[model samples]
Target: MTSNDAVLVLVVVTALGFDFTNGFHDTGNAMATSIVTGALPPRVAVAISAVLNLGGAFLSTAVAATIASGLVDSQDVTLTVVIAGLTGSILWNLTTWFFGIPSSSSHALIGGVVGATMAAAGSSAVKWQGLVSKVIVPAALSPFIAGSVAAIGTYLVYRLTRGVSEGPRGHGFRIGQVGSASMVSLAHGANDAQKTMGVITLALIANGTLESGAQAPTWVIVSCAVAIALGTYLGGWRVIRALGKGLMEIESPQGMASESASAAVILCSTNFGYSLSTTHVATGSILGAGVGKKGAVVRWHVARRMVAAWLLTLPAAALVGALAYWTAHGIGGTEGVVVIFVLLVLASVAFFAASRRAAVTPANVNAEWTGSVLPAPESKEATSWTPGST
Candidate 1:
């Protein structure tokens, strides 16, 4: 194969890898509340979300177009830039996942590409206005908008159902939570899956395999959808635990309100072709639910940490993206890309090994939050001294 073709192949593979991480990283956005509220089993919630995410990918190409052409100067993008960007995104995703933080995969991808582009070309290559208006403004505004909607929704839901019997009320809200959560999954697919498609499309444009203004090809759409769907099915249980249990204790009605708010905001943003972070919207909605309830407690400390991470995500990922670009550019050619790819693989393995030491699976995902992402250790005395044995 030609050298360009080989590089293009690598770019496509890396893009899909990013798509996979996007799926699992943000799965909690859709299903965490549902799982925590007993609206659906953990595995089942993710499974349902996976199917909806795949379906959502085909709903439109507007957001994909925005990603491909709106954020940066497509003329300046290169296969090398794309590769470095994906590396930055993947590493950031893994880092956040390991710490069980629900940072934005969307912002990471955008930051990586923008930073790599700046490193390769210059600040002039970026569409600064588009970045601010479409991305920055939306990011700043969306959380509050969603939070307000959720707060109102939560208040209304609780007030309206105040007279209902406790058992039936919980059961009814659980069912509503399932539907609202499903909409969120669909919205997430439409929003997040399109991001990888956009990156792949950008790569193709850079490689001259497609015209600069071209939309994402059908194959690109399908592949992104499937990769993300598969990743969603695997579930990011650590992130699930954090969003579901760490922020606040969510009742069924509040869960429904939060999911509804998230779904509405995401779907609306997708329609406008804005690639906003599902993580931000979902977290805000959850916080709103906590606030709206009469006696509910919002964990400000946990919320503060999340807000700090949100503030750091773009700049941190961009810094990594810039470094990746310099590293690859210094090494030169396909070899440089290969070297960075190898490093990414090694880093991923190391992180995975580290995570296994304090693994968060579905079984312990809903374990009582003990002020950390990892569950409290089972007592040795309890394990060794069973009542029957005693």
Candidate 2:
């Protein structure tokens, strides 16, 4: 294979790696509420999400088209830039996952690619208008929209069921959670999985293998779908712990409301070709559920920290992407790309090893939250870092 071909291969692998992280990192978005409320077993919820997410990936390519052409000029994107972008996104995903912060993976990927494009081809290479309309504006508004809907839905659910006995009401909501959570999972697949397809398409275009304005190929779509599905099946237990238990104590009713709201907003955005962040929507919906329920405690501190992380995610990933581009460009040629890729792999291995030291497995994922994503020690459940912990 030629040098360019080799680089393309690496880029595809790296992009898929990012997709995998995106899956596990955001698994909580679709299934956390169900798992938390006992609507489904932890493993069972993830399995269902995996299947739905895979099916959802096949449902749309509009978002993929947007990412491939809307965010940046396809002509200016280079093999090195693609690799750098994926590197930035992958690192950021791992960082947030380790801390159990449910940050936006969509933004991370976009920021990385945009930042790398700017570094290699100047700011003019980025399509600012498309970024604003398709990504930025949606990011800013999705949370509020989803949150409002969730709050209203949650209020109505409680109000309508006020006459029912607690046992049946809770059981009914738990059953409802299954369907709602499944919808969110499907929506997540339609939205999040397309991102990897877009990146791969972008890389393909950058390499001149495909013309500009092309949609993702069937192979691209299938590979991305399977990668994300496997990641979802593995489950992001750390994030699941945080969203399911951290933001607020999610009940069956609240869980159902939040999941339903998240599914609606995400599916709408996906249909509109907006690269929305499911994490943002899910987090907002969960908080709104708390707001809607009577006397439910909303942990402002945890929400505050997550918001701060959301604000930082884009710029931070961009900075890393730019730096990676510079490093690769400085070294020059395929060797530069390989060096960065090797370093990235090493970094990933390091993070995985460190995580095992205080792993958050499904076994204790639902252990009572103690201001940490980590299970309390008495439960023999080791904990990872949390936004609340120093």
Candidate 3:
């Protein structure tokens, strides 16, 4: 009924919009390995990732608690500020996705909130020390940590099974990869879903619907969980192409170990309330797997592009956040938010429709990766493609 109410509604909607983008953008993290390794079909891979992510959403709230309460001064924030920040994040997400860049949606949201808050209430509104100590350092280093661990695990797997016959060794590792990939899927759900829950919680605080320090509500958790789950099912086909195809070709066991290692690290961090980048973790794991395997090709140029994306993620989202906040301010508050929201809707529909022109479905998912309709079957150690099966 009032301007405040309108802004609150807009903020909630925008936060959820960010959640959807988070789902697809981050989908590559959970399922790329499994899909590439023939551990699961593309569609089945997504379906599994979605369900497990939903289940993981219920497992913990420590990470969500950090985002909702730790980063910014919740007491000084406004629904308008939150809305503008989310707008920045959503726009940045689309920009990155359009180019098929796998950026960190979590950092994008944080940077958005910080930039908007600073723009709205000045620098005094932020707690930079806390932000850097909690988010930045871990985000910068965790990937390397996870990557090295994955490389070690991958190498060990091969060394330990060196004496086994090729047939039995391949079969055993294929089975192992399924479980490891599942662990990664579960870990992804734990981290990414909590991010949306945190945003919604922040919106509630900004709106005064909840106490400044209140915990995330059941409704917030469920709504975010379901939204993220649906997005995961849809998958971000672009990043999927890059991740499943571009990095080392993940075989059954190697993909499994990489995903599993990343999953364990992520879950441990979530429990500790640190929101590290899933993109960084997943990307690093894939790279590590590349290093562990013999003659594994690491495309330095493509990887350099991804590394560039990682570096830019926070600052780019922050710049967008500042701009969104100022734009909303210039347009006179709630009406400006409405304008942005309308644009977001139009942009989203157009993008999705355009994507449909040559939609990447499950059947077509691995096709581009292996240069064939089916990555049918072959000897595990066989490097070159079979003429008929890809």
Candidate 4:
């Protein structure tokens, strides 16, 4: 392969890598409520989501098209810029997952690319109009829409089921949560997986391998689908713990309502070619469930932290993307890409090591919420016999 071909190959691989992180990082969006409410086992929940996500990838390409041509000028995007953007996105995803924050993977991907594009060329290269209409507007509105729907749904669920006994009501809702969560997993695949396809298509156009405005190639679609599916199967337990337990106490009825509302909003946005953040939608739906139920603990402190993360996600990822682009451009050529790539790998390893120190696993994912993602480890005194107290 020629040097340009080599760079293009590296870009595609890096984009797939980002897709992988997106998969695991956002698994909680679809499965967290179900797992927390015991509608499905943690492993079973993610496995079903993975399969549905793979199926969902084949459902539409509208979101993919939007990402390829809507956000920025394809002509201005280069291999270095694409790789740098992926680097920024991957790092951010890992960071948020480590802290168990359910941040938007969608914004991180877009912000990184936009930031890299601006750094490499200038603000003029970005299609500001498309960015505002397609991305920003949807981001602002989706959570409210989803939250409202979930709140209404939760309220109705209680009202309609008031005559029924608690046992049957809880059992029925748990069953319903399974189907609703599956729909969310499917919707997630249709929406989130497409972002990667668009990025890879963008890279292809930049390298002159494909003409501007061409749709994502068949191979691109299939590869992205597989990558995301694999990542989903791995499961982002840290994020799942936070969303399912940290945000609020989610019962079976609330979980069903939240999942159903999120799936509807996400699928609708996908149909309209809007790149809505599933994280925002899911988070809002969960919060709305709390609101609809009287006397339920909403944990506004946790909610506030999530809101802060949402506001910061775009700019923070952008800064990293711009810095990565500058570093790669400064080094000049394939060498720069390699250096940044190596650095990203090191950073990822560091995050992984740190996470292992207080790892969240399926075994303890459903543990009581204690105001943190990683449940505090069982103290030796609690687990073992100390002579002092019996």
State the lDDT at 356 in candidate 3.
Answer: 68
Clash number by candidate, in order: 0, 1, 0, 0
Candidate 3 per-residue lDDT, tens place, 1-390, comes to: 988887777777778788888888888888887787676778888888888888888889988888888888887787767877887788778777766677888889888888888998888888787688778988888878888888888898888888988788777776777777778778888888888788789888878789887889998889888888888888887777677776656776678778877998899888888887888898888888778877778776777878888788788888888887788778986788888778768877887776665455666666655557553345221233211111
Error of 1 at 348 (Å): 1.2
Q: Give the per-residue lDDT digits (tens) of candidate 4, residues 1-390.
A: 888998998889889989899999989999999987778988898999999999999999999999999999999999999999998889889888887788999999999999999999999999999999999999999989999999999999999999999899999999999999999999999999999999999999999999999999999999999999999999998788778877788888999999999999999999999988999999999999999887789877787888888998899999999999999999999999889888998999998898777666777665443322443347321222111111
Candidate 1 lDDT over 1-390, as tens digits, reads: 999899999899999999999999999999999988888988899999999999999998888998899999999999989988888899999999888888999999999999999999999999999899878899999989999999999999989999999899999999999899999999999999999999999999999999998999999999999999999999998788778877888899999999999999999999999989999999999999998999999887888888888898888888899899999999999999888888988998998898777666776664442222433347321212111110
TM-score, every prediction = 0.95, 0.96, 0.92, 0.95
- After superposition, the stretches of candidate 1 with alpha carbons farther than 4 Å from their true spots are 367-390
Least accurate stretch of 10 residues (summed lDDT) in model 1?
381-390
- Taking all chains together, the TM-score of candidate 1 against the true structure is 0.95
Backbone clashes in model 1, listed as residue pairs = none
lDDT tens digits, residue span 1-390, model 2: 999999999999999999999999999999988988889988899999999999999999989999999999998999999999999999999999988899999999999999999999999999999999999999999999999999999999999999999999999999999999999999999999999999999999989999988889999999999999999999998889889877887899999999999999999999999999999999999999999999999988899999999999889999899999999999999999999999999999998998887777776675444233544566434444355341
Q: Pick the candidate with the highest TM-score.
A: 2
Q: Where is model 3 more than 4 Å wrong at Cα?
A: 374-390
lDDT (CA) for every model shown?
Answer: 0.89, 0.92, 0.79, 0.89
* Runs of candidate 4 exceeding 4 Å displacement: 367-390
